[model samples]
Target: MSLSSFKREFARHYNDTPANYIKTKRLEKAAELLLISDERIKDIAFNCGYNDLANFTKSFRERYSCTPSDFRER
Candidate 1:
């Protein structure tokens, strides 16, 4: 199958583009780590595949309405 065909099928099955799916998974994992561990927010962001803490925090806030550290504190 062509790349387009595969991507379309994936979207139809998952209701999300691959990039969105990946970002969602990464954020979910980061939230899980925050609840389960005492690791620093930046470290958790890095472990969740983010290289820059600001971008990670931005994305986290967009998804959850709070920064990673604030999310963890609550």
Candidate 2:
């Protein structure tokens, strides 16, 4: 089967596309890490599969309505 077929089956099984699911899960993990540790935001972004700090910050803000540092501060 092709990658598209797998993606379709994955969506049918999980009710979310793989890309969205991955992004959601990564942010969730980042949130958890922020709450549980004293790691820097850049490190957390790297751990969450985000290599670019700016992109990670933008994505995090979009998902959580706050930057990683702000979320950690709360």
Candidate 3:
């Protein structure tokens, strides 16, 4: 299938754009790691496929309304 066709079908079934769905899943994994692991936030972000610490912080905050460290502390 074409990229656009796949994106449309993916969004139709998932109710999220492909990029957002992937990003959300990544953030969810990060949140789980924050709660369950002793790994540092930057490492968790990297493990979750984030290349930039600042971008990870911004995305995590947007999804969870808190930084990764704050989420872990909560």
Best by lDDT: 3
For model 2, the superposed segments whose C-alpha errors exceed 4 Å read: none
> Count of backbone clashes for each model?
0, 0, 0
lDDT of 3 by residue, 15-69 (tens): 9999999999999999999999999999999999999999999999998999888
In model 1, the Cα lDDT at residue 12 comes to 100
**Candidate 1 has what TM-score?**
0.95
Q: Candidates sorted by lDDT, descending order?
A: 3, 2, 1
Candidate 1, 1-74: lDDT as tens digits: 99999889999999999899999999999999999999998899999999999999999999999888888898
C-alpha lDDT of candidate 3 relative to the true structure = 0.95
User: Please, what are the lDDT tens digits per residue for candidate 2 over residues 29-74?
Assistant: 9999999999888899999999999999999999999998999999
True-structure RMSD, every candidate: 0.7, 0.9, 0.5
Inter-residue clash pairs, candidate 3: none
Candidate 1 Cα misplacement greater than 4 A, ranges: none
